[model samples]
Structure formats: C-alpha cells, structure tokens
Target: MSNVEHVTFKNRDMYWEIAADIYYPPNFDESKQYPAIVVAHPIGSCKEQTSGEVYSAQLAEQGFVALAFDASFQGESGGEPRFTEDPSLRVEDFRHVADYLVTLSYVDAGRIGLIGICGGGGYAINAAMTERRYKAIATITGANYGRVLRETEGSAEAVIAKLEEIAAQRTAEAQGADWQVDGGLPESTEQAKELGITDVDILGATEYYKTTRGAKPNGLNKTLRSHMGTAYGWDAFHLAEELLTQPLLVVVGDIQGGFGAYRDGYEIVRRARSTKKELTVVKGWSHYDLYDKDEPVAQAMSKLTPFFTENL
Candidate 1:
C-alpha cells in the first residue's frame, strides 16, 4: 500500500513549474529519510498514465519514495509551445526532478534511482549517463522515439519531405495561422479503423492511450509538428556503451513474436556499460501490454521491485 499526493516543482532548464505526483510508502515516516526514485512517463503522456503513476505507486508500496512527473510543455506541466517533445529538455527534466527529490528532507539524495516508461526510458538513459545522482536506472518497454520514427517512416527523401512540411508549418504559423497539432497514436477506435492501422505495436499502444484503459484528457495524442526535427536528431542512448556506467535494468516484452521490446531494449542492453545490468523479457506481453493490464504489470514489477531494492 502507498499514499499518493499531488506535487509541483520547477524545471532548472527554464524554471518553469512542472506537475508531478509524490507516492510515499503507506507507513511513511517523515523523520526518516528513505531512498527515492523518479518515474518518467511516455511521450505525449502525463503523470496519470499507466506507466508513470502505476509504477510509482507500486514502488512506493515497496517502501520507496517515488515521483512521477509530466514532461515540460505536456500534460499539466507549464511551458509554452504546448506538447513540445524535445528530447534534450526531457532528459534535463529528469535531472531537474532529481534536484527536487534531494531537497526533500525525507528522501535520501545519494541513493536516488530512476524508472522511465516507453519513450521516457531513452531520456532516462541519457540523464543517467551524466547525472550520477541516479545510482540505478531502468526502463520498461523502452523506446527511443526518434529511432522508432526513423524505422516507421522510411527513406532520406521521406525525412527531407517531413522536414519541409514542418518548415512550411512554421512559416504558416508566423503568418497568423492557428496552432497546428501533430497527433501521434489514433485518439479513437474509429480512427484506427479508418487509418487501417494494423501494426500490433501501434494498435496496442493506442488501446492504452486512446481508450478508457489508460486515457487522460490532457494527454491526447498530439504535439506541435515543429518538434519533429528535435526528436529526429536526439538519441536517447547517445552514449550507452561509453558513458552510461550506472546499474541498468532493461525490461522488454517477449510478445509480438518477441519483437516488442527487442527493437530497442536489446540494443541498449548490448551497449550499456553497466557491469551490473539485466534484461528481463516478459513472456506473452506485447509492447503496450507493459503500460497497464494486471498480468503484464505483475510480471514487470516483479523484476523492477527487486532491481530497485537491490541497487537503490
């Protein structure tokens, strides 16, 4: 059991207020400082989503202080250009959350850890690389959104065309056009059918984000189209084999015929420099299954709880 409460803090990058939830152990004692961990949500997601709050609550139940936060310019966080999914800023936000964690008298600053879900996982890796304050780090069904985009959208010509489209949007906005939004996954079941989007990875993800299963109004599947280039250039595990020296845990799904998490998690596990690292593949779980659903969560948390406990 754990106690959940709303919290807010500033992002050091620009001092903008970021929204978050603090999950404390059910028997939390303010007089005693406890190890803490930061939980990062997926791209286009908020603190309330499955991977963010769900994992935070679970960790808190295990006697760890957990903080789940919305990235800057998305969810309930304060920032202009709403829904800007900048990788650099996202990575910096993790460190900023760590900064907030250390300020709490009941949080053990030196023993802090981090858990990131989906796209957040990549940013967490980037953050953990230089922010040694994170003694341990982990990502579930992790993905480098930039890399995912590249794989999904083929060709240099296609990329150049996207860049051109974004550039045109920027110009149109300057000419007083309405704020254009770039939607990610389909927002409704009807829309999925209309698009003929049958990819299991995307279909599974939409089920979580577009349906009542894990949907949040403020967390619609959209971001500014201008963020395309930023996401395209940023690499989540930019220096894994070389600079990521912290204890790393990469949990991938063995579902979708084992292509679910392997696409990203396996590569990271292969390259990360952590002498203490583990890549646990959850059987019969698809990429999106890790977001919620009782069985998959149980499978993922079994390993995560122990990993954080042993390391953090």
Candidate 2:
C-alpha cells in the first residue's frame, strides 16, 4: 500500500550518517521525475515523531516524495556528545539531505522544497536564505529558537551563570561523569502545572510529546543541558528578512507558547525578503496541535499540497 524505506546518507560537513525515512507515492514511477520536499521534525525529536512521520507520510499519500530525518547528534543519526542542537549543523543537514534527494533519477532537483515544523521552521528558513537548492520552504508552528525559549525562561546574566555550570558539567563529563540532561519540553502534566505554563501552545506540546499520543523513544523530550546551550545561542531572524529570497509560507496558530506568536511566525513575515509570502493561522489549534491533530494537520496539508505544487 506504500513505498517507504529506511535510508542513510552523510552530512555535508559532519562525518555522521544521517538516518532518514524516504516515502514514495503510490504508483510511483522511476521513469518520471516528481517534485519532492524535505520534512524536518522539531528540535529534540526524530523522524518518527508527529511532525516528521505523519507530515511525510500524508504528503507521500498525496503524490509527493518526502524525506524525514534526524539531525546529526540526535535520534538514529550518528554524532558524539548527543543532543548538541547546533543550528548551523542542523541547517547543513537539510542541504546534505537535499544533496541525496537530487541524486535520485525520479526526483526533479529544481523542484526541491522543504517543510520545517516547530523549531525546525527556523532551520528550514536558515537553509532557504542561501541553500538555493530548495526553491520554496514552509513551516508549521515555526519557532525562532532562542527568542522563544530563552526569553520565556531566563535573562542573559542568568544564562551566563548557567553556561558556567555547563562548563563545569563538560569538564566533569571529560573526567568520567555521566552526561547530564534537562527536560526541554513539559515532561508531565504535573510538571506543566508546576511550571505554570499558561500558553496553550506549550500545553499542546505537553499533550503530544509527554503523552502516548505522539511519543517515541527516539524523539527524546530531553537535551544535554551542558553542550546544548547552543540551542539558545542565536536568534534566527537576524538579517533573515533581507537575506531570505525564496517564497515562504508561514503556517502558525493564532496563539503560540514557547514558540511565541510575534517571535516565531509573525516576525518572519515582518522581516523576510521573500516577495511572495503568506501567513496562515489555524483558528483553534495551538502550536503543537498542528503536529498530529486531525483538523490542523489536514488544514496544513491543504496549504502544503498547493504550496509545493505551485512553487516547486
């Protein structure tokens, strides 16, 4: 009924082999070239999570070939000091995946596109700024990583102090201490309540990642607090409005959580150089609802199907 297979390829700069699931539409013909899209799961997640697997699977069912993969240091992908969350490396992963995708005879290189979800929306946009290989890009509940997370939690001075602690942890690891992790998303309903998470978007993430609804062992809800500070290092919007030239479709919930409304989706629309861009807001869904919610996912696909077909 489907033609999905596991595959591996090398990252452009990193030595690790990226793990991916490649999906081909039903009645796929090798003799014919089809437009394709690279789908990115959220940060701290993998191909099996809601954004990656479901997005890729459903898109394939609609006739586009889709590739979903883990980032260099996460999930099934090979990398040391697990859960680095390096934005630059993550951006390159998309390029390298595009490299592998273009080599397929049944794929049209010029028609290549990308779909980045949640935090991945930042990476996908980062790639589109100059990758050139991808003609168009879109994101669902896109998050500008540093702005949303760092702003929600701490100040620069406190982050510096935390960075010092991370330095100590790194030294400790080198001295044979075990790698330490911090739960990035809401790990439980009780924890969510304790954190006083009032944002509906964050609540949606709690329902998906922490619960069985979209849970996967590979999509760890935790990250190494020491080395993973890189996740909060830079904001993705700097120069993005001037540098981003490709068509962009920013699909965001009217309300956002850790991925804030103004910082994530609206900021991109406010600052991208993409002349052809549109922002769609799903009325009732929060950021995480688009991950696997029936209505939101279908609403997003309605946009994705046409966006790629017309742009790529």
Candidate 3:
C-alpha cells in the first residue's frame, strides 16, 4: 500500500482551485520517472470515494502514479455557485490535470493515461479525443450525461421543457432570487422504493451514496439546478469516431435500466476510431456494482491493468 497526499492547484484558464490526491506506489522513488494515471470520479461524487479510495489506490499499488481529483465546481475544489455539472468545463479539467502532471519530474509526461467512472468516464473520453496527452483511456461504466438525459427524458419536447424551466430558474437567480439546488438520493432504499424509484441503477445509487459503503461529506450528491441545462444540450461522444484516436478500453456491467452506462459503453466502443479498442462486459453486474463491489472492481482491473500496461 502507498500513502496519498492531499493537495490543491489552480485550474489553468479558470480562477478557482482543484483539489486532488496523489498516490505513489509502495517504495516510491522520486528520482525515477513513472507512468501516471488520472482517475476521475462519477457525477455527484468526490475523489474520496471510488476514485481515490478504490481505483486510484489500486492503480498506484500496480506500480503507477495515480491521481484522483475533484472537478472544478464540485467536491473540495473552489468554485462559485457550487455543484455545477458543465460538460465542457468537466472535459477541460482533465487537460488541466495533465498540465500539472507534466511539471512533475517523477511523472513520465508521455505515458499519462486516464480512468473515468460513471459520468466522469464520459468526460474522460471527450477529453482524450482532443487532448493527446492521455496515451490510453479506460472507462468503468462510462456514461454520457447529455445522451442519458435526452434518452431518459422520454422525448425531445420534454427535454426542451426542462431546459425552459432551467432557463427561467437561472433568470430568476440572476435577478437576486435564491439559487435552487437539486437534492441527492433518498435517505434509504426503503425511501427510494416508496418514491417509486425502482430502477436498478437509481436504487443502487441510493444504496451506495446514502450509506456508509461510499458516502463522503464532500460528495454532497447535489447539483445546481440552473447549471444542469448545459448537460441537456451537450454530447460527450460528439465526433468521437473522428477525433478519438488513443488506445481505448470500455468496461461496463450487463444490467441495464434508467442509467444508460451499459448502452453508452457499447456505443462509445462502436463509435471511437481508436486503432486499438476493447470492451469488457461484466456479466450479471449492474451499473453501480462496479462502483465498489470487490468482484466487479477486480474484473475491471484485470482488463484495465493490462490495457494500460500495453498502451502506456
């Protein structure tokens, strides 16, 4: 096991700071340059949960320097009107983290790779498309937020209606009204059932986020209501077939429902123009199972470790 150090750095081209944890392999030597991996968390999650505690920790143990960081306006990072989930800014955050990694003498700048979980997985793919710094990319239950929103809303008319509502709320806030925040998961699985949220994905999310299994104080699980409209119109996989040329790995569970990761994973694998790409479907596992479940995580790592090793 390796010790992780908590740190913060200014986000380039942005005013606020980004908080992160850097994991060093056991018996790490600063004098030697090592390949590094950037681990990005799911939406409504912080570095402390699966990103840093699980994936980053394991990647470091496998002899690579792994970084897990909070996105610009979420987690411990400094930003105004927090919990904003802007897709463009989220994609840019990966490049900014790569900038920081390159300045470190212990990191081999040319061998940097990425691991994105849930929504972060989608952003990671988008980032890697334009930014060549990431030599390889892997997504665990990767989800495109915009596509998911569009699909789950049932119709384009419904999406537009929601966007209209968001626009009105933003206008109201600009006129000195109080900001409206979206709430997180239900208090418990029972409460979720009562709310009629029976989808395996949402139910699993409630269980993971609301319980001791994956809860962290900074993983507030809320988002600014006004900022969500940006995701409705954005697409994480836009032009992926043309611009995504890096070695790619997509890992997803078999179970499917409200959350679109399972389908999105296959879609990305199908769309990416990467010369070397692979998709591993974890049988019998739901989308959230890969979040922290021992078996699923192990299965994902088995593929990820080799993919990164071969590519990076």
TM-score of each: 0.95, 0.94, 0.98
Q: Give the top-scoring candidate (TM-score).
A: 3
**Which of the two candidates, 2 or 3, achieves a greater lDDT against the reference?**
3
Off by over 4 Å in 1: 257-260
Query: Across residues 76-162, which tens digit of lDDT does each residue of candidate 2 receive?
Result: 999988878778778888878988998899999989989899889888888788789989989988888777657765798877777
Candidate 3 on 165-209: residue-level lDDT in tens?
A: 999999999999998989767888889999988799989999899
Model 2 quality (TM-score): 0.94
Q: Give the Cα-based TM-score of candidate 3 against the true structure.
A: 0.98
- CA error at residue 132 for candidate 2, angstroms: 0.9
lDDT of 2: 0.83
262 Cα displacement, candidate 2 (Å): 5.2
Pairwise TM-score winner, candidates 1 and 3: 3
Ranked by TM-score, top first: 3, 1, 2
Which one wins on lDDT?
Answer: 3
Q: Which wins on TM-score, candidate 1 or candidate 2?
A: 1
Per-residue lDDT over 1-312 for candidate 1, one digit per residue giving the tens place of the 0 to 100 score = 238888888887796899999989988999999999888988778888864568888889899998999889988899988978788888888878888888999999888999888888888888899998999999988888777766566876887788788889888888998778878778776788799977777787678788788888876768898666787766787878899998889988877522235678888989999999989888887878888878888988999888988997
**Segments of candidate 3 deviating more than 4 angstroms:** none
Per-model clash counts, in order, read 0, 2, 0
